[model samples]
Target: MSPAKSRHLNPKKLIRSKWTSASPRNKEKHFIVTNIIQPESKDLPIDLIELEAVYSGRSFALSWRELTNTQDWLQGWR
Candidate 1:
C-alpha cells in the first residue's frame, strides 16, 4: 500500500484545533489541541503540544509534528 499523505499544518495556529485518530484506543477517537508547549529558550521553536480526549477528558503531550502524519491523525473530527 502507498504511504498516507502528510497533512498540512501551521504550528502557529495549532491551538484549539481538533483532530481524530485514525486508529483510536480507549474509545478516545476525538481530541482537541489544548496547549502548545513553549520552549525554555526564546530562540527555540515549538515542539510539543497537549491533546485532550473529548470522550474521556484524558490528556497527553506529543510532538506537534506528529500531527502531520496522516497515518496516525486526521485534521478534524471524522
Candidate 2:
C-alpha cells in the first residue's frame, strides 16, 4: 500500500474529535465529530462522518478522508 493507504485510522476513536475548517461558512470555524456512520458490516470500511458546528449547532455529513486534508481541515480546533 502507498503511504497514505497504509496509514491507520480508527473510526470508532474519531468520535468527539475536534476540527476546524480552513474556510468557515457563516463564520463558524470550530466543529466536532458528533457521529460516525458505520458500514452495515464490520468488514466494510467507514465512509461518512457527521460534523457539528460549535457556534451554530449545525451538522453535516462528509467523507472521512476530507478530514485528513490539512488545507481544508485541521485535526483539532483552531
Candidate 3:
C-alpha cells in the first residue's frame, strides 16, 4: 500500500516531544517524533500538530474538513 493511503486510513500516532531553534538558512521548523502508536489502536488522530515559532521566521498552519462535527482547535487564531 502507498504511504498516502495508509495515512488516510489511519494516521500513525506520533509522540512529538521537542523543538529546535530555527535559523536563517533553515526556514522550516524541524520536529522529532519520539514514538509511534501501535497498529491496533482505535480512531486515528484528526491531524498531527506542530508548533512553530513565528519569531524564528516560521509559521505552521492547518486546515481540516468537518469530520463528524468535531470541535475546532484553531478558533483563537482565526
Q: Best candidate, lDDT-wise?
A: 1
Q: What is the C-alpha lDDT of each candidate?
A: 0.93, 0.84, 0.33
List the candidates' TM-scores in order.
0.93, 0.82, 0.22
Least accurate stretch of 10 residues (summed lDDT) in model 1? 3-12
Expressed as tens digits, the lDDT of each residue in 1-78 for candidate 3 is 332111122223333433343222355434333334333445654453434443354545322221111231211122
Better of 1 and 3 by TM-score: 1
Candidate 2, 1-78: lDDT as tens digits = 333323245777889999889899897999999999988998998999999999999999988877876668877877
Candidate 1, clashing residue pairs? none
Per-prediction tally of clashes = 0, 0, 0
Off by over 4 Å in 2: 1-8
Ordered from best to worst lDDT, the candidate numbers read 1, 2, 3
Error of 2 at 5 (Å): 14
For residues 1-78, could you state the per-residue lDDT of candidate 1 as single tens digits? Answer: 998788777777999999999999999999999999898998999999999999999999989999999999998899
Candidate scoring better on TM-score of 1 and 2:
1
